[model samples]
Target: MSAEIILKANHISKNFGLTHALKDISIQIERGEIIGLIGENGSGKSTFSSIISGVYPATSGTLELKGQPYKPSDTMDAQRCGISMVAQEMGTLPGIGVADNIFLGREEKFTKYGIVNRKEMYQEAAKAMEVVGVAGINPADPISRYSLEERKLIEVVRALYSEPEIFIVDETTTALSQKGRDIIYKILRRLQEQDKSVLFISHDLEELMTVCSKLIILRDGVFIEELEQKDFEEERIKELMVGRKLTGDYYRSDYDGNFGEEVVLKAENVHIKQVLEGVSLELHKGEILGIGGLTDCGMHELGRVLFGIEKPVYGEAVLGNGEVIHSPKQAIKNKIGYVSKNRDQEALILSASIMDNMVLPSLSKISSAGLIFKGAEKKFTARQVDGLSIKCREITQDVKDLSGGNKQKVVFGKWLANESEIFILDCPTRGIDIGVKAFMYQLMYQLKKENKSIIMISEELPELIGMSDRIMILRKGRVQKIFERSPKLSESVIIKEMV
Candidate 1:
């Protein structure tokens, strides 16, 4: 990384109406450097990056790019100023082709006399897709035709097409599979080779440590600490980010793999066309069944098939009582909970209030004569808010206002409030900080102790080995191997089957 300063934030602060999103924060970015930003939800990490990328005008701050005063009117202006951001949330436009989505703002190249040239657009889009290592996707197909992971990869390509001087990657890996992640990492390294800079924001500490040359910690909208490449350590960075020392094993250290013989949930020959092929599994009472795989291995689709969110052309997902679940309502009625990998799009209602979202799954319990009681609902919501320690202004606070980690907490709170007996958590700790991730692991452990079953599908191998009673490795939509958890189980052993 070069010693030259590329971007500088001077006393930056942001506010949304009455809420202070960012405090007086100052930081510097060096050319040819990958900077990692770490903090808990609502901690101003995203707020700072957003301000720098011109997503919103900062409440107060001064910015300098390449040793000059830089103030972008908007995201487009920022892009023109050689700064680009890949947002935490999905930003692709629906109903458009992949090519159109990648080149959304740069359409002038394909326009002639105010008319768009479709053939050229498709060709350019395909080239970008290939450059990003995305295969088997038709550029002419609608963006909606692809999965969430594919869409995220497309966005990465979009950001790179312009070759911006500085790139902001905001919690994007949560939406990606391993293949997509590898491609992104390669792209970042290549950017560094070109002496460009990257501001990488993620909850995955290991990833940050591996890729970042510098680390910045933020808390409750305040700057905490900045560490050099030599100072990158998982536990230390985690402690600094949370503003307290973590006191226990991050994952359950116990090796008691014994679980109930009676199965709580079972998937039999489940199939989702090309996505999942005859995938099957059994979740016993009190067992954490960890599912591991690479992208295109069907682990994600398997979660949907088992939860009744995606209808399977073959086989069944059965409850203990021989009742087959065919719909989300049926799964919920049977005490089954599903937290999708794409938390923002598939799991939570971003624009709704905390109270409304918390009470959504169990509306029947809080309603009388199809009329809801606000007092009773607020009480129920408050319990979850306290239980999960969700940082929010009020129960009436919009979920969109909360940070990424807190938004995930709201999703967990919803399921916990419903008293779900069987939980299907896909990338449950994807975008959360270490403190919140540890809490989530504790919750899973407590649930296991209570004899509730869990199916944890994650790209994170450590989480799988740390918490699962048994691990199932998948490849190309088929079960490759299932290993009983032991002290000897390691990521290397499980990864052999995954690839």
Candidate 2:
């Protein structure tokens, strides 16, 4: 027998001022089905999911849930109507305990008369965490104490607690490690067994192929095609998403590991209060130095220290000119840029416009006689936006309105406009689509050719192997091994050092 339709969206369209995010799109979800939504940046993937999850109201559309007219006023309304979502951006609030974040809108359940039952809430939160296979997280502790991956898991637990019939996951797995991904996969399988439905959105084609029984493709705010599991093809999907055949190598073709002798940035015996222990490395001129390890490893911290965002308790990061980096001002003055892993929190200001963010780092350069030129600022911002192919109706559009991948592009554009000599990019392509990833890799290669240095910190081993002149593996706050790039370099060899 055919499966029952749980949700149906007909003639759905969304508009943001002059920008039309979704254009006459229609789709349906089936019970016990896990559908993968694939698209490039700004392809209406998130906008569609947001409409269903009650983040936004469609300018024109009709939604029916179990053959009943469904119109949710807000996220809570959607949840109450048997729909829940784990968004792409960080969803948990800071300065609150994990239990509070898990049961944010439903605290009345633990409220007795006029008082909230903290103990009961904590117990239930603990059980929820356990259900998602997340351990060592105290429900009473502040959510800020946890890492990005841990916070994402907490959001997952929150979504699951709603017991929704239809769940939407929007580009969430890109921030997760293999272990965290396994936990998510297990949850999806369990949901399938229970005859629930899921809308899985991700840029990782291989991952989508593995978890989804069918795929839906979108391009330029239009529905392009849909493919069944039997017809899945990576190249075909890429072509459909971008509306063109992807040409050239995704990463650098040559395996030559040679770099200039001059050390652009050097760290000596750096220590980060239990996160890194006597760790040291050198980033050479025109070299792509890749740092790889588990999510809890100290690579991300090391990047911060190198960029002078965090001061090491023991040692220091020095420049080629023998200048000891002490603060972000000093680092930026010496032409260093940092792209943080937590993009939403540390990298880009969501409330600010794209032009405001792109010109922030280059203000001094564009200023004359202690006065800023609006024309120059606009020109500078325009160059980066056009060069990066950032999808936006206008540069005045807020960064938060753009898709996740486009938001990341704004972060990169600011640094590129500043003309930094050394870049410390931590997970630069975290939530970006494949088309943007290719452009970024090419841009890095171009930068290397221009004699600029880059230190790329990523969790994906394939990316490290593909682009780095050298790969450094860290394990439990220490440098385990540093391998020079070569044709024979493999993830298996690197995994041995990471664990």
Q: lDDT of all predictions, in order shown?
A: 0.89, 0.92
- Provide the TM-score for each candidate, comma-separated: 0.95, 0.96
Q: Which stretches of candidate 2 lie over 4 Å from their true place?
A: none
Residues 348-438, model 2: lDDT tens digits: 8899999999998788999999899889888999999999988888999889888878898899889889999999999998888889999
lDDT of 1 by residue, 1-499 (tens): 4489999999998988788888999999989999998888778988888888888888898999999999999988899899999999899999888889988889999999999999989998888878767788888999999888888888888887887999999999877766788888998998999999999999888788898989999998999999998988777887787888888888998998989999989999988788778888889999999998986788888889788988888889888889998999999988888999888888988889999999999898889899999998999999999988998889999998787778888998898899999999998998887778888999999999999999999888889999999999889889999999899998888888987
Question: Judged by lDDT against the true structure, how good is candidate 2?
Answer: 0.92
lDDT of 2 at 21: 86
